[model samples]
Target: MKTMRIWFGCSMGLAVSMIFGWSYGFFAALLPMFVLVQADRWSTPLHVQLVLEIVWVTVQVSLLVGFFQPYPLLMTTAVAIMMLFKCVAMQHKSTYLFGFTGLLIGSILLNFASYNFFDIEEFSINLWMCGLATAPITALAYFLFPEPECATPQPVTVNNEVTKDEYGMVRQAAMGWTVAMIAYLVFNLVI
Candidate 1:
């Protein structure tokens, strides 16, 4: 049931994005949707999350391959950002208010930052449109799925060490953002 909802959200989002010339939006929207469905839970298993991310990214790349310049970095980086926003949205619950706030604030800040850093055009409709749908999709998925489980981990201290989980959610999230950013910078530099 939960899995079905996630797929439904992704399918809906992908359909919308394709119509609007933002195929990446589908993947971006999924982050929040997935998180929203699992929000009540403390954490999801890393492997399961990774599989979803890979599948989403693959679909996104395949869909947009015909139109956009074949820039793996750009596509992957965008996916990373979508995933991050989804994580944040999930942590905050699937409230439309939060989603709206993130869309507005994030869009403004991201556009402004791009203008300053990349010196690119301001307020890209495609980018902002993606942001607009990101939160709603997440909320919708959350509403559709049953409340997530509240898993409790063992007590931890400075003395306790942690092991890497699959999907390397934390690590990949960080690496994705970093690599994407670096790739963007390099692209800008070369172009």
Candidate 2:
């Protein structure tokens, strides 16, 4: 059942995205497969949650870009500071998903906003559309392949090593962001 849902949602989403050639349409593929795997039930508010997440990130990126577009130095600094905050917040115990989504979408949009022709409004609308596209696909995936009834529900484990987990996540997030920023700088220099 899980396999069917993943395969159907991902493949169908990829197909639809490719066919329509939407700028931010990859969300259609990613969200459905991701939510399909993460959701325990079909009727969860996955679609709404995803939209809100995307919208929040979009607003963040748009405002930063809009305010700093004329000054490249300020733009870079603002983007770096925001990314650092997102990276650190993403590793925190309580706000992982929200920060992670912001980091993912904000990084991409920020990079694109470097170009003058980039359209924030269009991207935001298309992003919402891509999110909306997930609802029906997820519903279909759930309807077609419902979770099997298991006699025993698996036990959920709580991690007691809060400091260890948070430290490791912070270290990893910093390393990742550092490497990404350096690479972006080097690539820009080369290009």
Candidate 3:
């Protein structure tokens, strides 16, 4: 059942993307897959997923117009700081969301640079539209196939010197930083 839901959502997203065009469809398909997987693990609400998508689109636009071109160094520094902050603040819960956002922003910036900077406005609009399109598809998937409840939350056990939870936190932070750096590097290389 779970696997079916994943396939259904991914196929729908991919179909929608193909209708829009190749470039847009790729992300349209990809974002829903990411969201569905996260939703399954965390049991994140549809509203929260939608909110995150909005935030992702907003951050992408802001980075492209306000900071990416004019102050590339400043933009990269700010993204690194923000990613680190989210890592520390949200810990395990935010790992996927923050990391994915960083990658998305980086890719968007890279695309803009590779094409024409003047198209930033249009690109931002298309991204927002993609997010809007993805939201409903993901929401429907979650609605159709809900997550199973755990009887009780499991406590993290100690491993080596650190608790499993602490180890996870560190891993999340490292992942966040790595994504941020890769995105930054991509942006820098393009522009």
TM-score of 3: 0.65
For candidate 3, the C-alpha RMSD (Å) to the true structure equals 5.3
Model 2 / residue 34 / CA error / Å: 2.8
What lDDT score is found at residue 128 in candidate 2? 72
The whole-model lDDT of each prediction reads: 0.47, 0.75, 0.62
Residue-by-residue lDDT tens digits, candidate 3, 23-85: 545666666766676656424454365446556656654664465556867666766665565
Task: Give one digit per residue, the lDDT tens place, for model 2 in 132-180.
Answer: 7888888888888888887998788887773756668778888867865
Instruction: Score every model by TM-score.
Output: 0.36, 0.78, 0.65
> How many clashes does the backbone of model 3 have?
1
**Candidate 1 local Cα displacement, residue 79, angstroms:** 19
lDDT of predicted model 1: 0.47
lDDT per residue (tens digit) for residues 1-191 in model 1: 56766676677678777777663454455544545454443233422343343434334433433333356566546634654564344233233233333333333333333333442122234444554565566556556765555598656668664654645655654664465455545544554
Query: What C-alpha lDDT, on a 0 to 100 scale, does residue 129 get in candidate 3?
Result: 67
Candidates, ranked, TM-score: 2, 3, 1
Rank candidates, lDDT, best first.
2, 3, 1
